[model samples]
Target: MASVALSGKVAVVTGSGGGIGRAVAIAMAEAGASVVINDVGASLHGEGASGSPANETKALIEATGGRAAINTDSVAEWDGAQKIVQCALDNFSRIDIVVNNAGILRDSIFHKMDPNDWRAVIDVHLHGTFNVSRAAAEHFRRQESGAYVHMTSGSGLAGMVGQANYSAAKLGITALSKVIALDMGRYNVRSNCIAPIAWSRMTSSIPEDSPEKKALVEKLKRMTPDKNAPLAVYLASDAARHVNAQIFGVRLHEIYLMGQSRMLRSVHRSEGWTPESIAEHAMPALQGSFMSVQSSSQLIPWDPI
Candidate 1:
């Protein structure tokens, strides 16, 4: 089989200290793209910062004879985001691909969630994606070509208990990527989202002794290890130029494209319809429409460009 290569391209991956981000950065580098790896080196809750993770990933890439640089900027601020992208421009001269994979979790049920928790998660996930993508989009438009991959979560699509804040922010990322893809198509910029189920530091906290935990672990084990980054690497390559504004659920040896359909039905009005009469007639339709609006389905047989 022929391999997908990204020679002559410059790529940036955020939060690449470890886990999926690390895998993606290394895969891009191996594919011949000079990579800029960014990580705040914080904990799962976005607390604290260190340079160890970023430096370690960079060293590993270089050791493997790949081109890479370390960036230690938090994506929560505009200036920080700008510097992260600037690292790519300064080192590689231009950026052709970006994977907004930096994220943190502030999990809590809606009632118990504090305002600070909600705001913090939103800042890092939703606003962080905006800051980085906006800076990259400008350069992308100038170059007339670029690819973006935004990291979302299955929780955002299916919803999970005690993760109201995290889920909301992730869902916002999906929406943002879709809108960017729609608006930037004319500029030859393609933006897509990925919801991945992987075993990372973030998921290690779940106990493995329980039956539910064992089942979840088995499911995740079925997902390819960090080596299964080609799926994301492909999305960040010229090969996927035609794919835009879509979401994919990535696992080891499996790729599932997420399909969305319209939730609203067309409305027709009759002549001389009064407000009261229309309200009376619409009650049953309104109730019936609930099912369609709430309905969501997972795509079978994963495929990507």
Candidate 2:
């Protein structure tokens, strides 16, 4: 697999200190891609920075006979993001893949959420994705080949309470992925998103104040970080060459091809009547197709199995 599929390729996985990012980095290394482990070593809420996590992942990859380099640049800044992609060239001489797995959560309910919290999450998730992907785009265009695997979330794809900022940023990632795929397809560069359902540091932050929530958390725990790594690896490799601009979800043993924004039902009026008539006629015609407001848990109410 290495010799034929991914040998001589380089991959940069941002926020790779631990959890999903770390898992993806290790998987990339194992699949024969020289990995750049980029992490700011921040907490779940984007507090503080250290180099320990990135170093540990680098060591783990090397100990298992995989080549990896540590990079501690935050993806939120264009300069920092540029350095991350450049790290691959410096260490491996070329880059073939970018895994936009870096993220920090600032989950808050809509009413009480502060502006700072919203901006922080958007900066890291949305802007960071753009910054890193844009930085890599230059090389990808010149070489005429590259693959991008971005970390989206159920919180974004599906509704979740107390996470308006997160949801918005996440859903926005899907749109960005779609556009990149469309714009870069001529260059053989592809972009795709993964809404991973894993019990990692990110999920550890979920409130567990009641038995029901606690039980849900337990089910979540079974969906370990590694469960999502294989899909990321496949997406980054040439194996998914024909797959582009698609949204996927990795949940335990289930891999879902999630839906994008598409019209379910459309109402057309010959005359385009007044507001009241339209509301009365068009709404009734469209009401059956209207989506219900449901959180991620409510929609997937069954057990993980």
Candidate 3:
């Protein structure tokens, strides 16, 4: 089979300064795409900024003879996102792919969580995604071709304690990607989401010197951002033009497609039923399919593979 190539293509990868975003940016460039590496160089908690990370990533790409430029704009802001897209047009002329990989973590127990924490995470993960995607949509629609690869998470797909804010935002991105896929399909635009389990500063929250944490780190070492990058690159390639509106998961060597929400089973009644009748009839039918109330970790209790 012939290898997938991105020659003559241009891509924009938000949060490309480090981790999975950096790996994806480099991979896209290696695949022959001119890339816009956008990153404000914010810390994991979305605090502080530095230009070094974006500069280093740009340098790395250039060192390998890959065409790339850096944009230190916040994707959370509408104007900043427009500038990021404009940077791509200014340098590469046209954009063929957009990878929304930038996000911040603000984990806290739901009841005890601060409103500011919730808003901060939502603004970055959800609003930032909208800002960039909306900016690119106009160009993609005019060109009649584009691909969107968004970063989602297991925290949203499954469930994670102390991550209500992050989980909600991640899940919102998944839905947004799906809607974009539906709306842009006719224009040859594809949008898909990936819930990846790879180590980054975000996962550094796992305390050191614990057995579970040690196991997770070992597994993550093998996983790497590189392992996850190929999938993003593939989604952006011409080969995956037919693949859209899907949720995928990458864990170590495992790559799986996730099933979205759907009715598992249904029951019908000859006539309208009261609350008592619903309890008597519907409860029994749905009981067998009911998942446990506990979160993913509480149910499985295993380290990342």
Q: Please give, for residues 1-305, the per-residue lDDT of candidate 1 as tens digits.
A: 44468999998898899989999998899899999999999998888889999898999899989999888988999999999999999999999998988888877778989999999999988899999999898999988999999989877876676778878888889999989998999999999998887778766665688896687666665554374477788888877888899999866666778765465764456765678766877655566665432211132223222
Off by over 4 Å in 2: 1-4
- The C-alpha TM-scores of every prediction are 0.87, 0.97, 0.95
**Runs with alpha carbons beyond 4 Å of true place in candidate 1:** 1-3, 207-210, 222-228, 264-305
In the order shown, what is each candidate's alpha-carbon RMSD?
3.7, 1.4, 1.8
Q: How many backbone clashes does candidate 3 have?
A: 0
Alpha-carbon lDDT, every model: 0.83, 0.91, 0.89
Residue-wise lDDT of candidate 2 within 1-305, one digit each (tens)?
A: 53235678999999899999999989889889899999999999999989999999999999999999989888999999999989999999988999998888887779999999999999999999999999999999999999999999888888899998888889998999999999999999999999999999988998899998899889989999999999998988888899999999988999989988888998887887789987899889989998888887787766677
Which one is best on lDDT?
Answer: 2
Ranking by lDDT: 2, 3, 1
Candidate 3, residue 66: Cα displacement in angstroms equals: 0.4
Span of ten consecutive residues with least summed lDDT in model 1: 292-301
**In candidate 3, which residue ranges exceed 4 Å CA deviation?**
294-305
Cα distance off (Å), candidate 2, residue 301? 2.2
What value does the lDDT take at residue 27 in candidate 1? 88
Against the true structure, candidate 3 reaches a TM-score of 0.95
